[model samples]
Target chain A: MPDATQSMEAIEQPAVIKRGSRFSGYLRAISAMVWKDLTAELRSRELLSAMLVFALLVILIFNFALELDIRTRETVTSGVLWVTFAFAGTLGLNRSMAVERDRGCLDGLLLVPVDRSALYFGKVLGNLIFMLIVEAIILPVYSLLYDVNLFHPGLMAVILLGSVGYVAVGTLLSTMAVQARTRDVLLPILLFPVVLPLLVAALKASNGFLQGFNMEEIWPWVYLLIAYDVIFIAVAFMVFDFVVEE
Target chain B: MTHSSDRRLTPCGVKMIETQRLVKTFGLKPVLRGIDFSVEYGEFVALVGPNGAGKTTFLRILATLSRPSMGEVRVAGHLLPAQATAVRRCLGVVTHQPLLYGDMTVDENLRFYGRMYGVRNLQQRIEDVLEMVGLMALRRDRVRQFSRGMQQRLSIGRAILHDPGILLFDEPYTGLDQEAAAMLDTLLRDVADRGRTVVMTSHDLTRVTDLADRVDILHKGEIAASVRRGEVDLAELPALYFSVTHA
Candidate 1:
């Protein structure tokens, strides 16, 4: 059914496809990054296992280090949980980015035909997934140990907000940190400072909900969390091209 | 002037990477100073330079990993700066590190990159590349466990899995033992035979003399000499390379 001359031309000197016009190319690029990170994680269990073990260990140490009385638990729960998450998030982010840099996979990925934002999303999603898996594992374990049901609807929302915030800034900062001479140690130092807004908002929201605060008491924190997530994600998306550019 | 037609003989029926007056500087030290170069669709061109001659800088520019301070670069007609994303869509890169996740199995790494490159039928492509690299059996093993040579083999597999029309290698064969290097050489030749353009940077002139269709000497941030493969005797090349850089 094909035209003979056109087919011959295709065989002799095939035409290359343009990176599709429209947002579809952007969507495709994003999916490519996400798919790449998730598949790699699924195969190796590298980042997840490391984060999970680290999270559990943090909770265990917190149990001994901090008094478990009801009053102390109420005030410290959100702070304690987010701190653990922040710490664990860095562990996964730094390790993953460092691995990419050390192995020279970053170079290969950069050579791909996609916008650099795709790389940012791919790494962020991968890191977020790893952090969430750790959180999921930690929640039940912490619930059993602390006699608190961490599966509250509000808490889940807070975790999602916190993670989105953490991942957004963490991905961007980690990209920069990985390129520096100080790689592994540099990620947390860099990530924690930029992500304070996300941390504060999520922590406040999480704690307020846990203490059964009124709607008026909780709305401010929730607003802050949403604003933090959206703003940082956008900033991260914009700056990604510069960071990945050689 | 007569040799200009000879330059056109290679099968890169269309140019893969073409640059005009490309300039890049870092920390106020200019690396590529208003340089112009092009690699045809299937041409095997070696960017030969001493340490700090800006070979890597130029390759990075073409790869869209770095931007030039100024100039025009077109990768397969994808106008650079404005259309780097478009240019990146068609190119493939193999660098010194292999750039794979060490904790993941080889299959996972390949599948991830295949998706990143938007390669259709990713599984089939991964299988074909693995088989080509002779790493089909080790697909389940984590890359962290592989030796330096084995890792490089997988790196090559990752780069070629997408079947990019343009393949850029930054000292890809540097760390390999002889047998592995030979395998890499044969694979590169096979890729070239299929009409893929390749631009590689290397320090070893003996190997470059044997492998490159043409060679360009980059010295002190500019191309100092350009020679066809058969023109150079190996003994005189180091002197030429050193003198160019020094000059």
Candidate 2:
């Protein structure tokens, strides 16, 4: 048997405490988690490739189905873009969390000595970054296909706001879905209903930007997007601990 | 809050683990009946039981991975489900699953956990653990490419990365070849020798006899007997286990 006193003395102890305040430590943990996902995705590219391919497929199908002439193209571009993003964003969000659950990474993450909310934010940021990267690639492709400059600054802002709200809610709901028996089919059903408000606001604000509407005309949708993002992110942060709890 | 003077002190404090009438249930099925168990600092306790005997449930509660329904549970002196975060800081758990990202290399996986724990001088610590697990050469290899035994070794390395005061092993040797099992035996012995509080659950009575100072037979959500290593004959564990469980 091991000697308690001898073992205690032999254990290597840290000479200094390098930790910052609780808040900074929490933030560092969150960033570390996000970095973990990004680096993993950078290497595997499974989630990104799946999402990008799916987005392009949806866009390609829409190009033939809509047959948008110049007049109709202007009316349909915003709707098509937003719809593509919503569907593609779900793929990234579901896979990002599902991979964690399947690979036992979620349990490993839960065991870390950080706030649960930090884990939630870390996931949210990682999903958000992946979504943005897919959109960044899709935007130019859509621009080239439609012969329309989709690089407007206002439109970009709306996309960012829309993604934040979408991922904030999606990340929480996906955690729940991943634990279910029917998770493959359950996420979109659970998510689509709850996310209608954000999607509506994103579509309208996107259209407002695409049409070059005045701030007064576009403010309502932008305001709705901002409000949706803030409310969902806050709610997800608060309720995330419960969602991941066994 | 009574203190025992005979208890040995650890780096953290005395009384590494304590529980009173711990109970756990899933829906209406009670998995763990009211049971009192405690482990002192630097003790190695093995929980052995038949299937569905609540052995894993008990270990899970200690790991702070699962909550007990009705009991006062404290690990490393922190109340569970209430101060779980504080408890997690002092605890290391090795579940049946490897609990590692296969997509990342061994080095990357350790780096991620090292940063999450805010470990100081993390690079050196990662190198140390890799060497400890005998995976220094495989540090840059993807975990998905490693054999099951290698992955298990890496998982052990991951758990000890933070140097937790308490370690919980849940069927860690479930699926390993003879070579891996022998390597794990050596590693477990090293860990036990370090005098950290270790609680392991396994059905291998013969194996547990060699490692554990005390073997607890948990039957139907209750501890039927606690056999001290010094009192019981190692070769007679199977018969002793059957007599008590059958009764």
Measured by DockQ, the strongest candidate is 2
- How much is the lDDT of residue A140 in candidate 1? 86
Candidate 1 local lDDT, B156-227, one digit each (tens) = 888777666677889877888888887777776666666567799998777666667778898877888988
Candidate 1 stretches greater than 4 Å from native: A1-32, A42-46, B1-14, B229-239, B242-247
- TM, every model: 0.87, 0.94
| Interface residue Cα RMSD of candidate 2 after superposition | 4.5
Clashes of each: 8, 0
Separate DockQ for every predicted complex = 0.43, 0.43
- Which stretches in model 2 have alpha-carbon errors above 4 Å? A1-17, B1-13
Clashing pairs in 1: A103-B99, A104-B99, A105-B99, A113-B88, A113-B89, A246-B65, B12-B41, B12-B42
* Residue-level error in angstroms, candidate 1, position A34: 3.8
Tens digits of per-residue lDDT, candidate 2, B79-120, equal 988998888877778888888998999999999998888888
